[model samples]
Target: MRIAVGEDDVLLREGVTRVLLGAGLDVVASTGDATKLLAMTLAFRPDVVVVDVRMPPHHGDDGLRTAIEVRKRLPATGVVLLTQYCEPEFAIDLIGDRPQGVGYLLKERVGDVDDFAAAVKRVAHGGSALDPEVVTRMLRPRTVPSELADLTDRERSVLACMAEGLSNRGIARALLISEAAVEKHVTATFRKLGLAQLTDGHRRVQAVLRYLAAQGP
Candidate 1:
């Protein structure tokens, strides 16, 4: 898969490029500037972009903003935003209403080369990859009543793993349950969320986002 990287830290940028390249993915462009990153993305139209949440010229949420713009202008290109810390607000803005072809991960995650590569590939192929920590943090603050309140604790745990973009098999591994059990929980969760009609991937995204949106902020 073709990839582009945008990070202000020189060492980290090179490290990310090396990691993706070593993973057998094509590296079409790398840049430290958010604007240039967008320009390069437009020029190359890479399959996925690994962008730091902060970059040159602003060093704030420039990369996150650029990722959003890329989604708007190049809907086919996937984007993964990396942050030094867990930033739930940025993730919310990045995912918006449509969470497909997007990811939000901590910078430390890049050290896990295999998983990081898999995340990029997952997003490139129209799947999501939210960091487990990000998902946990997002879920911890909910006290309001919503559709999520209708789910059982086990179902909630399964949905949390789903929010991390894990497949049923992956969720089974994480939750130490059988794949059949995961399937049952997923089905029940979908039914309770009124998402039984959408396709699998679409419903999962909608389910997670609906819960998050109801939780507020």
Candidate 2:
């Protein structure tokens, strides 16, 4: 898959490029400026664009804003916003219109080369790969009669993992539980959240976003 990277840190940018290249993915473009990222996206039309949430000048959400614009201008291109924070608000907004081909992952996750490569591939193929912390932070009680309140702790764990765009096996590995247990929790979570009708590979992502969005900004 082809990928474009946008990050202000030159070292990190090169590191990301090397990582993706090492994973056997093509690095079509790389830039330190968020604006350049959008420009490259329009120019290269990469399969996926891995962008840092902050870039150039003020270094606060320039990449995120660009990602949103890219989504609007090039709906077919996949976007993955990398960040140091577990900022779910930006993520929720990224998928406000739709979740296909969008991802939100913590910067630290790059250490796991295999996982990071898989995430990029997933987004390229019209899927998601959210950071687990993003969901956990999003689930904190902030409203009464919340949709998330209906879930048990384990179910919530399953939902959090799902929000990160992990498969049942991935969730099991992360949580150190059996795949059967993870599947059960996923089914139960979906049923409780009324997501049964939307059952599909992306259903968990949709349901998690529904719950997170319900909490409002």
Candidate 3:
């Protein structure tokens, strides 16, 4: 797959490029500036773009802005955002318009080449890839809706697993329950949490984010 990178750190840009190249993916362009990165993406039309959270000229959200721009300008291009810190607000914003072909991963997690490569591929194939840490922070105990508060402890566990990006089968394996049971719990949890009306995957992510945000820091 063709990919572009936008990271202010020289070493990190090189490391990520090397990893992608080693995985037999083409690194079309790599840049430390968000503006140039956007330009490169428009010109190259890569399959995916991996970006850092911070970049030059307003480092805080430059990379993030570029990601959003990609969503608008190059709807077909996937985006993978790597951040040194987990910012739920940024994650929520980046995921606002589309959850498919989107990912938010912790920079520290890049040490695992296999996982990093998998995340890239997942986003490229129109799937979500959120850092486990991001999910944990987003799902911590909070004053959930009264309806959600009614879930049994086991059901809550199922919901938590879903927030952590686990598939029904993965949740089943992790909780030592049958996949069928996991699906049942998920359906029940959704109904109780009033998330049953949300059918879009992106909206579902936002629903979970809103629930978590209401629960507080």
lDDT of each: 0.86, 0.83, 0.82
Best by lDDT: 1
- List candidate 3 segments past 4 Å from native: 141-217
- Name the weakest run of 10 consecutive residues (lDDT summed) in model 2: 137-146
| TM-scores, one per candidate | 0.65, 0.65, 0.65
**For residues 10-83, could you state the per-residue lDDT of candidate 3 as single tens digits?**
99899999999998899999999999999999999999999987787655567888998998889889999998
Ranking by lDDT: 1, 2, 3
Stretches off by above 4 angstroms in model 2 are 144-217
**TM-score computed on alpha carbons, candidate 3:** 0.65
Candidate 3 contains a number of clashing pairs equal to 0
The digit string of per-residue lDDT tens for model 1 on 59-145 reads 556788799999999999999987786867678778888889999989876577999999999999999999999998777865645
RMSD of each: 14.6, 14.8, 13.8
* Model 3, position 86: C-alpha lDDT score: 80
**Position 171, candidate 2: lDDT:** 84
Question: Roughly what TM-score does model 2 have, to 2 decimal places?
Answer: 0.65
